[model samples]
Target: MSAIDNLPPLREVIATHQLSARKSLGQNFLLDLNLTAKIARQAGDLAACDVLEIGPGPGGLTRGLLSEGARKVVAIEKDTRCIAALQDIAAAYPGRLQIINGDALEIDPLQHLTPPVRIAANLPYNVGTELLVRWLTPPDWPPFWQSLTLMFQREVAERIVAQPGGKAYGRLAILAQWRCEARIAMSLPPEAFTPPPKVSSAVVHLTALPEPRYPADAATLSRVVAAAFNQRRKMLRASLKGMAPDIEDRLIAAGIKPTDRAEQISLEGFCALARELRRP
Candidate 1:
């Protein structure tokens, strides 16, 4: 039995099922239950939350969430091979675990999940950023989930919580910080996985704020941020010239310098620019 639960150790489960980490699928199984449980705890109290976990290869984090007292867990797995192993977990927890065999991007998790939701996953490296963008940029304020505790490559995690003036800070920093309180909760070494990854990984925990830190139209902010960062090396004036004929004036009005580059601008500065651009 594993330290956290009665389920067999993850390596045994993987061997029994013949599951190997697939580079095409961005799979790196976290075989240590104690470690998975540690990652799960970063999500905060799960006793009242239904967690949505993506890419739960061989049921490591799935078992972690269950053992940690999550109210319920709805796990989405794209790999068909991992279903039977996950079923073993479901049986151990009875009604608390629901395993869905499908791609995370294609499936709508809200159908299976109830309110007060939190998402925790050791996300597939290939689609991790894309999934995070979707979650942070949903149509409305106060998204379906209350919080996100997700693992990503250390570089990607840095991008989420990075402040202005760093190479890592750009569109992702603006997008995430504009709407949520984000921070890196934990870091894992490359050797932690079954077949160790080349780079290290870290977990980012983001709690949704009731309202955005600064108010601006979401679409407009996204457009402005995207445009600015797409040509990050250029001065704001040069990069944003096509946005409006009076782009420099608008920049000055928003308290931003026309000479500044994208990475030098703060989330508030970007939101202010978005507001100015929204005006006639």
Candidate 2:
């Protein structure tokens, strides 16, 4: 039986189904039910919340989400082999588990689900950053999910919660912190996966705020941050040269030093620049 959910052990299910990790799909199955349970618990209370799980390889984390009393789980997996495996999990939980057999990037879990949702995933490494940024830049506010509990390469996690003036801060740092409160919750080594990733991984917990730290459009902020960081070592005046002729004046208006590198400016500072960019 599964340690947390009393379902069949994942290994047995994998063996029975002849499932193996598929690298092209970025699959690294987390076979440890206990570890998955811990990741579920980190999403805070789940009693009444819905869950969005990406890449539910063998349904380990999916089971943990349901076992923790999530009202429903919307799992999206791209690999066809895992769909058969997840079908077993859906059967075990009855109506509470909903499986979408497709790439998560192609589906917006928010539109298909109700409020009080929290995204909890041991995400496939390749698409994790893209997915997180989408949530952070939701066109509308009071975002679909109440929280995000996601795993990423240890370096990526560091970048998410990194502070200005630190080596880890950059485009991701500004985008994440401008709108949500994020921090690293836990870390797992490469050995934890069925086919381990070369780099260690860590979990990041993010709770979205009612609004951003300052009034700045997410799209504009995304462009500004991405551009600034693309030439990070250069000062803002040199890096943000694409803007109007007086872009340095704009950065100065935003209260950011014209000489500051992208990594040297805080999230609020980036928002200020984004706001200034919106000006005519």
Best by lDDT: 1
lDDT per residue (tens digit) for residues 227-278 in model 2: 8889988998999989768998999899988998988887788888889999
Q: Identify the runs in model 1 with alpha carbons over 4 angstroms from their true place.
A: none
Q: Write the per-residue lDDT of candidate 1 for residues 140-256, one digit (tens) a residue.
A: 889999999999999999999999998999889988999899999999999999789999999999999999999899999999988999999999999999889999999999999
* Poorly placed runs, candidate 2 (over 4 Å): none
Estimate the TM-score of every prediction.
0.99, 0.95
TM value for model 2: 0.95
Per-candidate clash tally: 0, 0
User: Cα RMSD (Å) per model?
Assistant: 0.6, 1.4
Q: In model 2, what lDDT does residue 1 have?
A: 65
lDDT of 1 at 163: 96
CA lDDT scores, all candidates in order: 0.94, 0.88
lDDT score at residue 179, model 1, on the 0-100 scale: 88
